[model samples]
Target: MTVLVVAAIAYLTLALILVYAIDNLVALFFPDAHSAMPLNFPTLEKMMAASRKYYRK
Candidate 1:
């Protein structure tokens, strides 16, 4: 049915958006959170890299 198809599409869109938002937030606030993981995947490294450094003087 057309209604079912539309609902499915909307659900998928929302799911994608949710994942993107979470990834951005994690990258922003907890970039090194995954650094200790044993796996050395390139994609994981990029995702875990921080956009900016924090320092105290």
Candidate 2:
């Protein structure tokens, strides 16, 4: 359990770093520069879209 917790934390940290690096790289290579938002993203819109698709009566 302890090992799993440590691994999850490390995994999350690495994933965030990789996302930043990739976002930077893409922006550097693309004509229109894209940047990560400096704030948290909410999943409610995505969740609602998915729910609507699957839950239509």
Each model's C-alpha lDDT? 0.78, 0.83
Model 2 regions lying over 4 Å from their true place: 31-57
Clash counts for the predictions, in order: 0, 0
Instruction: Give the alpha carbon lDDT tens digit for every residue of 2-52 in model 2.
Output: 999999999999999999999999878885654554333566667687899
Best-fitting candidate, scored by TM-score = 1
Model 1, 1-57: lDDT tens digits are 999999999999999999999999988987775555566688566655643332221
Tell me the lDDT of candidate 1: 0.78
